[model samples]
Target: MTLTFASPDQPAIALHVIDQDARDGWLEAQPPQVQAWVAANGFTGALGQVLLIPGADGAPDRALAGYGTTDRRARVRFPLAAAAEALPEGTYAIASGLPADRAEIEALGWLLTGYAFDRYATQSAAKARLVAPDGVNAARVEIMANAEALIRDLVNTPAADMGPDQLQAAAEALAGEFGAQFEVTRGDALLERNFPMIHAVGRAAEQAPRLIEMTWGTSGPKLTLVGKGVCFDTGGLDLKPAAAMGLMKKDMGGAANVLGLARMIMALDLPLQLRVLIPAVENAVAGNAFRPGDILTSRKGLTVEINNTDAEGRLVLADALALADEGAPDLVISMATLTGAARVAVGADLAPFYTDDDAAAQALSQAAFQAADPVWRMPFHTPYETLIEPGIADLDNAPAGGFAGSITAALFLRRFVENSRYMHFDIYSWQKAKEPGRSKGGLGQGPRALLTALPGMLDL
Candidate 1:
């Protein structure tokens, strides 16, 4: 449902800012009865205390929310969002003059507080809804939230139901909804089309490997999004530990996120030619699974020696990215839950993106703030190019030493996109714990930031 700003006839709810150090001044400025009442009952501005002060006529005056010295950024977003949930069912504005950052933060908190990921659940009573401020974009906020929810739902589903065929179906459904052209290249046809790496990585599975492609819009800069759609990773012949395999169902999170972002782009009708490519595969272990030390030819004509079969995301992404780069799109971006080193560096909350274009990096950083989706820029150190060099083949899909795993993965994908200005995002698309907007489940990374910035990035 849409949210709006205050109406002309409606009464504006006052938000009185309270702090620990500035409580005395606020108390002194209050009326005699209110001051006496507050003094009688010890009231310090300790985070989230709500107190209603009565007038001399015995009526409620305003709502007082305590935010202990708003100098530091709170660890939990709960405090900033308390007003949205705690306040009475009515429109409220920030009555006090807050810092620009905090003001924007408060606005975001209000939007996040309204997020409900109950796609399959039955709707009941309406929860709290707030009006946007003077210049805030309510539609954009809701779009981002809805897109994230879509990604979460797709990733949360089990691998049994969300395999390669389901991945292609999801892409086809999105295409049908947006009236975008859709196609899939499956089975041995993958090999015929020079996607040998994709076939090699996924041929072991009962379901065939397929490339999911969708295109929309006709007259603007070409913006291509390539996502790694490893439906489930059994780690091929290499195999993963039982503990690590627990959350492997979320391996296709990158694909889900791309579709989520595409939903926003299509919904907004952004003036750009959008192309989405997802290489759908399931790295299941079987008798015919690709093994280590095997040489595989990629769509880009690069010979890659497989040092580890577990690093399969890049193999599927290589073919999709090659197809995207063939059109020489102005901007081609790819996202994948590709490496463990990225998780070690930034943890699960942040996605580390690699790009050689300075303008793209700046645009992404700005977009992250605009969309309330946080992403950090990681270096694409060109000197590390030699790390993936193989003695037998042109390149090694998995290097001997696993030093800079995330960086090497980005470099490997770079070999696929020769002409397009490309960027790669290494995301841990699962939240270990619950938070304000992000619940404890499969999380979407990089899409919000990418979706918000695409207009300016492509000069649309």
Candidate 2:
């Protein structure tokens, strides 16, 4: 909740970023005292290396940061994070031989280093601040940083506090803030509303499952966002190992990320009509829990066989996608942490996205690199359609053989979405270790790339 953006044109301490090839020339132009300090410390301009120079009054002068050579292979991702995190709590300016987007990159890292999840703890975060770098829009950078922070906050909260009801409250509050319309279909109402698959997957838990819907923007092309809001996945009738259940709280991370993206779109006032749909549920075990071998009817009127109750996220998402497809929106994107195969295929950092639209796929590929967000476009392989088909039902919720699990799961969701230009992101959402700008907790994976690519795609 800190005001991270500042507008001071000049600052006392500055970070001069240099590459190894340009280090000697930059240092020779410096004052003799600074040259002596640099020699004393053996300051070779390696990536992430930091050097502190001394002033004439024996006080601290401007700092030095090393960005590697101009070669793409030598460059590091989020390189400014090290300098930003190491700096003390004061405003600083940026001086570097970076590309045209240098100002935006440095400002983003400055805000990222200040993030700390101290809700239940007594410790305060490091209060590092920076002046708005030249040529960068401070307001735009803050909008993106705040949205990413919101995603981490919602995903990091324990399931005991973040359940189906809390998820609905978050969406309602977001809609109210922007004057958007909001409604939730709860409990038995889901059955009456023709969302039978959603109701069956969540009826076991004490917290009645529901669908969270929000509508905004009165004009422009329509974009419908559907997120799998499985608040806590207990694996239902088929249980999981204790270690596997440890991070089930993060199953709702897709919902958190979609909400974050929605926040960014509204904050920027993009020229597009946006609607968010989340099927919030808790797949817990009870006496009346839906069992395996149960063939349930979906909102799309297709019957799905429950091969394993553990595969409940897709069931809830199927109904939501059906409702979104009914409107034939310009774009439909569904995000979920639904498969272990995705993590196995691309690891935790790189998420896999499936899309049948070639132009959107190309745009997302380009945006991922420019935005510094890692996402790979996996094929919506038509050949894998046989894997999702069971003998008895129109589709199988949990297909066996474990071959191409992620592809088969995507194919299963495609059955519910018939007409829209669809994209599905199978994300991990939780970071097991700390990276340059990301911490060892919940992280937003694919939203930044979409934010960068959407305006151009919609011709806004």
Candidate 3:
């Protein structure tokens, strides 16, 4: 399903806002046509409810979409989505009564209502065109929609068609499209490059695990993005049960989201030296699989004890983060489908990000609010550092206590990062169910927010 922006000569649809307290003169200021439409349809402004008034020829004339109150920002997005569902498959323009900046979000809403993941089945055609409002930034809206579509497509694809090698191809494709330099270090080369933790976690898979690196831009402050690219996590030696492993195909959602962000950055042509580091690996079970209670060396020269092989995202990320740290970029941010604890804490809609730098955290939070991407700030409590201490080694991959799992995971990744200002996002990449602009699949967590924030960060 696709949402087209149209400028047809077809009759326009007036969006009549319904108000419940009509007797108290709540809707006295409304136009006669709107008042008549409300009276004719018997519409009260209850949330999520909509009414269609018929024209003189007995065809649908205009729509009355109910809202809670005039002063509230309590508009229902799904009802707007239901407009896409209920309206006759054709183009429609909002005649009046919507805030100026909301057009972009409304366009996103229109596109989202038509999104369907039909990889294994046939898809039905979509028929809804939300006409762009005058003076609205249609190009920006289209860019965001395409970026989101890219992320959703990658995340929804099954592991059978998207593995480590395929992930590399995707990254390389992104680099090629943007005229960026791309490189990959695989198999024995990982060991040669001192990426021992990466080699240890991925040695069992038929596909040799590697790091995908791409660099774009030539000037301004350096920005590095690191994403954990575990394609299909079988939990390695400490394997997950069947139920727990069901959604493991989305393990590389971090990689998908970063690629989406890259698409936006290059599309907008942000002035910054952009670097992307993705440690692509498949944590599959095999004879040579790394097991629990094993000590592993890291590229950063930190000795790690594998308390559980399922915590392999951090391992692969450690090597990648070490490489990013080596460059000492001005800013480094890493995102991952790293832990279930994050979902337990913030649910799927709002991803939680951890950062030691207050200014960067504020900037990210501000960006999230401005873009409507919405990420919560998780504390980077330095006291939690003790939770990741290893008795036998320099650090333990999995902490003993289940409490503060997400915080501990952030602490674990922080061990490999130094010199650069860093932030970590422990994201539950998949959305459980569909919402206004979010389709029910692997969701793009931070790209939208970061894309909005990067241009100014690079002084573009």
TM-score list, all predictions: 0.87, 0.96, 0.91
The TM-score between candidate 1 and the true structure equals 0.87
* Residue-by-residue lDDT tens digits, candidate 2, 1-460: 6437655764557768777788999989988878888889987777667776767776667788766566731344577776666666666677665556666866776687777777888544546577777788888888888888888888988889899999999889889988889999999999999999889989998899999999999899999999999999989999988898999999999999999999999999998999999999999999989999999989999999999999998999999999999999999999999999999999888879999899998998888887777799999999888888897999998888888888889999999999899999999999888756677788898998999989766777
For model 1, residues 1-460, the per-residue Cα lDDT tens digits are 3323345356655667677678899889878887888877676765555566666577556666666665532565445565455555655655663445555545655655554545557533224444555455656656665676678778987899899998898889889988999989999999888889889999999999888889999988998998889999989889999998999999998999899999999988898899999999999899999999999988888888999999999999988898899999999999898999899988888889999899989999998876567899998888888998887898888886778889988998998888989899999899788565456778878887887677677887
Report the lDDT tens digits of candidate 3 across residue range 192-267.
9888888888889989989999999999889999998999999998989999989999999998988988888887
- Those runs of model 3 whose alpha carbons end farther than 4 Å from true positions after fitting are 1-4, 7-42, 51-61, 67-79, 124-126, 456-458
Task: Tell me how candidate 1 scores on lDDT.
Answer: 0.80
lDDT of each: 0.80, 0.86, 0.79
Off by over 4 Å in 1: 1-62, 65-68, 71-79, 82-105, 116-126
Count clashing pairs, candidate 1: 0
Q: Rank all candidate structures by their TM-score, best first, as comma-separated numbers.
A: 2, 3, 1
Error of 3 at 231 (Å): 1.1
lDDT-wise, the better of 2 and 3 is 2
Model 3: lowest-lDDT 10 consecutive positions: 17-26
Deviation from truth (RMSD, Å), model 1: 3.4
